[model samples]
Target chain A: MTPGRKLLGHIALLVPPFGWLGIFYLGSLSVLLLSAFWQVDAMSGEIVRDWTWENFRILFSDTTYTVIARRTTGIALLVTVTDIILAWPLAWVIARKVGPRLKLTLLVLVALPLWSSMLARIYAWRLILGHDGVLNWGLRLVGLPDQNVAFTNIALWIVFSYLWLPFMLMPMVAALERIPASLLDAAGDQGATPWQVFRTVVFPLAIPGMAAGSVFTFAVTQGDYVAPMLVGGAGSEFIGNVVYSNVGVSGNVPFAAAFSLVLLAMVAAYMLLARRFGAFDAQ
Target chain B: MGPNVLMWNTKDITTAPTSWSIIYDKAYAGVITVPDNPIQIADAALYLSHTKPELGITDPYELTQPQMDAVVTLLKEQRALVKKYWALASDEVDLFKSGDAHVGAAWPYQANTLRAAGVPVQDIIPSEGATGWADSWMISTHAQHPNCAYLWINHVMTPKVQAQQALSFGETPANTKACAEMDALQPGSCKQYHADASPAYFSSIKFWKTPVRQCGNGQNTCLDYSAWQRAWQQVKQ
Candidate 1:
């Protein structure tokens, strides 16, 4: 095709999506940003159209910024690390070593939960992790005693890690499978042990996938409300809970908008820092 | 503008053209929006005035003590029949619109829309009473149109103006004097939009108060939402 025709075709493909994005996402964000600057008469539900930094001032004061920032970062980091650790072996086994049929079966197993509704999957975790749930039931069958372990921070992390495991494994497996078997064989032939071959070749080749997976897990889990809401009990109050409560129950839209903007900025900064450190470089 | 006046409508369920037993029996099983808003309480009080039922409620003013007790009993009995407890106006609207609920409490806007769409949604004001919220028009300290705002408030609060609004919004008129003028607007509209609608029932109806902690200045200071949430969870359990 001619360049002009090709360009026209591309434009035709892009225009509808661009139009929708402009009107819905971009326009709405712009309005939300504007709302952050305006004052509200809470009782009257009236909007006073004046530019002010009072909302941002509230965002910065009273330890709000410090608390959410620290919480989001810590939760994101924890989810990313834990998901990767759990996914590494599963991905490695399914990538190059397993037979094609078994590999596909295992892949189906990994992908199964992705087809379920996010809310249903999270609630399923609740059933599995509740005080009198299957996990306790199983423990009791095995002569283990029961306790109030489900309503804790650890349970939240486990459920979050489970929820994001597929994201990590799918990427890592694709990255690992792309490496030729000959390369690993060569490393082993050069007197490198099995562990050394993996360290020198397999791990190095999967860095990009690791980076992408980590980003996906961290970004998603940091803002996820369902898992925390279902499993975290009172202690599961993350940035998502704060944002939701501020907007809905509190009816403080401007403050919620400001906090959301701050969260976006922090996530962007963290991703930039990760990329700058060559976290995505596949050796 | 003076505080935007929130408006609502309710049916006269107490002395509807039908029998009280049939209505209540049908309502409990039929699907109705339980009043979750302040205005709904007032609207319900008004509806109760006209009807004399053999069962629990006949007076609206006695609603809080009696109503809460009734709800606890009803819930214990018919908890399974209630699909869900809706917390927002849109949720109740969805129930009616989607046919998840047939007879229930609803906001005026939703009812109007449903009626326009040819849905037979009777705005029930229980014979016991009609319950509703009463909002005042208060200008902000920083209002730009302080004079206009006050003008708007007084103008809307007048008998004729209040009746006109009551007819349109389906709310009980705030001005008691507005009752006479509303008769010209519609046959039953005035009675439906009475400020003290279903007075016999409403005289006993209790108003919804914001939850408060055991403190002197009860401006949402006492019981923080977190505490309320914990209580809600315990109540649910």
Candidate 2:
């Protein structure tokens, strides 16, 4: 093909996807950003389209929004920490300890939950965590007192950790598997203790993987309104819940858009902090 | 106006709960579930309309700032009792089925689904009345077949069809004549739903709608839906 023709072909290939993103993704985001500065007419329940900072004023001035943001961030962080704790050992076992045949099986098992519907999994957790659910029933059978953890922050924490565990596990497993066995042997020859080797070599090397996984756990938990609604109890309102209610139930698009911008700012700041910690350094 | 209702586990209480106050009762703390919507403020307003008449809350959807504050305060107290605010009908069904929630605001559909699953549950339009939604089928102006759409609407509005939908959905049939059809389809179903009840029974229900500043009583001092939404977030927090 001629050079000019090749250049035209490359441009043609890029145009569709770039145009689509420009129109749909960036276009909608710009619209949302624009709407955030607009005001809603109280009497008519319509967007007035006049530029104003009233929405931001309400969001920043209100303690309710502050409390919600704090709660959402706290939950997201908790879920991420929990997933890391749960995934690290499991991922390590699959990567180093387990046989090749078992490693594939275990990896598949980690990913199995993703295949099913999220709502279905959440509902299953609801049943297992309820007052008279299997968890309590088993406790009673063991002669312990029944526990009611359903519809609380504890349940939200459990469900979020469960839902996002695979995201953390897969990345950690990949990172751990990529570490050369010779490196570990070298450490052993130098009389390095197991814990010391892990702390100095394994842990720091896995930070990038954990950070990659956290991108999923943190973002999903921060923005998830469904899990909280299905499993969360009173006082479990997340930032997503507030945005959802405003957009869906109240039809207050402007305010919802404004609230989302606050959430976007927070997530962006969190990502930057994560980057500072070398979470994405490997990439 | 909507299919939403107050549902409770019949096995938990000897007698059926007949008042909205059951949800606020301290005994049911951490076991009650209400809706997680801004429109739910109407339920609190409905309760206040009967209990606090001096507030002059003529319409639950139209509440003055003071009246709204009173409702929000009451809801804040009730928030401690709520296990969760359900956003979906099936979630409430699961709540009752698993015995997670003993009582709270629910949809008639959830109650029916639970009972069908052999869960001992009952729903009521409590003594203080309740809030609901009136659903209507609409066709877009860009419809490809308006004639077919009209035919579909007419078919659905027929007594038999209305009865089938109303019974299945656990909602009131718009067609008054559907009462007999409902009884014929499922004996006592019409009575169970108050399908042929007096106008007072219908009037007791405050239909769900967007709350604007212009109160239904011609007052302009009422809080809008956004205020309720923000207040609800605060209450839950």
Best by DockQ: 2
lDDT of 2 by residue, A1-283 (tens): 9999999999999999999999999999999999999987766778898989999998899898898899999989999999999998899999999899999898888889889999999989987999889899999998999788998899999999999999999888888888889988999899999998999889988888898889889987998898887788888888898888788777789989999998898888879977876667653
- Candidates' interface RMSDs, in order? 12.3, 1.3
Error of 1 at B128 (Å): 30
TM-score, prediction 2: 0.90
B91-154: candidate 1 lDDT, tens digit per residue: 5554554444555544455566666666556554333433345556788999988999988988
**Alpha-carbon runs more than 4 Å astray in model 2:** A1-13, A180-186, B1-5, B137-152, B207-210
Error of model 1, residue B131, in angstroms: 19
What's the residue-level lDDT of A121 in candidate 2?
99
What DockQ does each listed candidate score? 0.03, 0.72
lDDT of 2 at B148: 100
Question: Which digits, one per residue and each the tens of the lDDT, describe model 1 over residues A116-156?
Answer: 99888776765676545778789999998864445356777
